[model samples]
Target: MHIKTRLTILNFLEFFSWGAWLLSAGAYMSTTLGFTGVQIGSVYATLGIASIFMPPVIGIIADRWIPAEKLFGISHLLLAGLFVVLTSMTSFNSFYMVTFLVALVYMPTLALSNSISYYNLEKEGLDSVVTFPPIRVWGTVGFIIAAWLVDVLGLKVSHEQFYLAAAASVLLGGYSFSLPLIPIVKNTSRTLFQRFGLDAFVLFKNKNLAIFLVFSVLLGAALQITNIWGVPFLNDFSISYKDSFVVKHAVFLMSLSQVSEVLFILAIPFFLKRFGIKIVVLISMFAWVFRFGFFGVGSPEGMGLLFLITSMIIYGMAFDFYVISGSLYVDKMSDAKVRSSAQGLFMMMVNGFGAVLGAYISGFVVDYYTANNGIKDWASIWFICAVYALIIGVLFALVFRYKHTGEENLVIKK
Candidate 1:
């Protein structure tokens, strides 16, 4: 197989492992395990908790001593076992412990995947900036496929989704061994912190980077809210009206967001170049307003479903433009030695600290607004999120400034 093809397969399995459960896990928690919103939110925060330091720590190891491929394999193997253990635990506290352990293993793989991809691409003499987005899009496709499969197979509310994910994890773990070996060349001259992408913090000395990091954290906090709440939000619509069509297939409907993700992912190069990060990200933020507003105001009936559908459509832009474009921006600014760590730090901010904050706060909001029957006051929740995004968007526009030279225009054409 071509190296690109092999990497594409790797990318697919990489995301498939997460997609099998991440989105639908809420349904399983709420409907099957009878977990409250706060409880489920706490469970989801495990990803954030693990991410706070693990990525950078593992990244330091990968940058210096361990080969990226080997570490990637071991993480997956550990996570597969954890997922199996998670499936066996029936109680909330036990499940939380198991899931947190799984996240400790699983979260680091995200950074490792990027590191391995960059390392292998360099070896193959490929342009990572040009090549990676297309490769990464397949990961979203895999995620979409997993959502569809879970919805269609009626696995969203069952333990089988974790089993399916675990199977994929095992496959991915074993397959990672077959990829080209990445060298372990440590930077002997550097201090301990420098090896961990901590050196990239120097960028914070620049006003633009400092502002970028702050907004990125704010936006990242906003980012996970939909994924954490979207499925359950839609599922609640069904509970209010048991015979409702939307109730029977809430997961499939929610899967539309992932479907839209593939299209937006392909559009990133075009959008990022023409509009630049400011406008492109602004569009994404505004899209989030619509995303939340629609959910808040619309229902499963009448024109409400239209609002729901539109919200899902805009999610493609909301997710892709912010994350993919922000990553590329970091790439443009950082040095090669610390690039992987910088990326991990970015994730730590958005996925780690941001996610933890979002999960905890969202749980409080849901618990405050929801009825005993588990029917949520979704409008209030989404409205609050929309306001939060709007504030961030305005702050980013007013505070974060950069000139979009034609450099990235040339980049996208590749």
Candidate 2:
């Protein structure tokens, strides 16, 4: 097979492993395991908690010693076993422990997967500039497919979702071994801190990077709000919009965001090159406003449905322009030696600290509005979320300063 095809398959299965349970896990925990609201939030926060340090630590190892592909494979291999264990856990504490371990083993794979792809792509003499976006889009497709399969197959409330994800994890783990081997040539001249990737944290010493990272964490919380709450938000619509097919098939409806993701992912290079980081990021922040506002105001039926659909469309820009572009920005800002670690640190901020903050706060907002029979005043909840995004956008525009000289000039694209 072509190297692109191999990497594409790798990307697909990698996301499939997460998609099989990511969006649906809440329903299973609530309905099946009888977890409380706090328990459920904590369980999902495991991803954020693990993401905080795992990526940088493993990234340091990959950069200094072990090949990224090998580490990627081993993480997934262990993840497969852990997912299997997750299917058998009956209590909240046990499930939390196992899930945290699963997240620890799994979160770092995100950056590792990207590094492995970049390493292999460069070796093949293919331009990641042109090759990677298309290949990575399949990962979104795999995520959507998993959401559809679990929902359509009646596995959302069962342990089978974890099993399905584990099977994919097993396949991905084994397949990762076949990826191109990345070298592990450590720089012996580096100090101990540099050797362990503590050096990547130095970017925080720069004023602009410091400002960017702080805002990245704040915006990242917005991303987490949607991912953690979107499924339930839509499902709640089935109460009033009972006859609406969109509400009935909320998972598939939300998958439209992923479909939109593919398009925006392709367009990222174009927009970032044309508008530069500030404008592109502003686009994302503003898009988040609409993303949450539409959710807050729109109903599953009536003309309000238009807002929901539009929100899904905006999600592509919201996610692709912000998270994806932000990663590229981190790549541009950091030196080559700290490349992997920088990516890990970026992941740590957005997926880790940001995600934890979003999960807890959103949980509070949800509980605040929740009433008898579990019905929630979603509009008020979403309104507050939208306000938060708006605040971030305004703050980013006013406080986060940068001059655009074109992305081609950046270290990442070059």
Candidate 3:
């Protein structure tokens, strides 16, 4: 089989496994397990906490010793057992501990998957910037399919989602061994600081990378808010605008974001090739402002529907350009020895620190607007988020002044 085809399959199952539970698990805990809001937050916080540190630690191991594909397989194999345990846990304490362990095993695999993909693609003489976005789009498709399946099978609030994920995890675990090996890049003469992730920290010494990473954190906060709130905000219209199709089919409406994602993913190679990393990423930041801007103003009626649809459409550009391109930038910029760790650092900043901040600030925004009677002013909340994105865009444009040479993605410096 072609290497890209094989890797595409791998990417598909990787995200499909995640989509099975990540989105609907809260609904399950809330409705079926009878968990309160705080309890659910505590349980879900496990993922953010695990993302904070695990990726870099595992990346260090992959960089120094075991091949990345081997580590990827081992992580998923462990996840299979963890998910099984998670399926049976009934108490909040036990569930929290077990699910926390689940996150620990699962989170690192995200970085490993990229490391594996980039290494294998280079070995096969393919350019990741040219080839990867297309393959990566399949992962999103797999996620959409998984989410749809969970709903179709009536397992949204059931343990079956975990069960299905476990099955796929085990399959991917075994298949990972068949993938091309990603050799360990180690220096035997390194000092202890250089050996233990201080090396990855050196990436911050580069001014352009430093600025990019900072903005990545701020932009990362914007990334999850739409996914978290879009449906519920649309649901608010279900009563007042019962005749609106979007109100009645909010899940399907939200799915438009993922659909639009595929199109933008295809377009990324063109934009990145022509514009270089700086312009491409700046476009992403601008897209985010518009993404939230549309939401803040749009209603459920005729023109408002266009606003909502436009918001979902731009989601493709907001996420793919910011994240996928950022990963490509990291891959191109870092030393091969520290590549995995560098990718891990990117995951840590965006998914870890950025997400944690977004969660708290978004929660505060929601709570502050929540009337004593429990009503929320979502318009004001989204407007605040839009303003935040606008400020980030303006600051990014003014502050991050990188002129992307056509050679920015010049072959990885050996």
Top-lDDT candidate index: 2
Could you estimate the TM-score for every candidate? 0.94, 0.95, 0.91
The 10-residue segment with the lowest total lDDT in model 2: 405-414
Off by over 4 Å in 3: 29-44, 88-95, 157-159, 236-249, 298-301, 409-414
Backbone clashes counted, model 2: 0
Query: Candidates' lDDT values, in order?
Result: 0.81, 0.84, 0.81
Predicted candidate 2 versus true structure: per-residue lDDT over 97-167, tens digit per residue: 99999989998988887777777787888766567778888998899899899889878778989999999
For candidate 3, the TM-score is: 0.91
Tell me the tens digit of each residue's lDDT in model 1 across 59-178: 767767777788888888887888877777778999889989988888888877877776677778996767777888888888888888998999989888898889889999999999
Q: Rank the candidates by lDDT, best first.
A: 2, 1, 3
Worst 10 residues of 3 by lDDT: 405-414
Q: What is the RMSD of candidate 2? A: 2.1
Candidate 3 lDDT over 159-249, as tens digits, reads 8789888988999999999998777865674689876755887788788888988887888788867655665567667557878876555
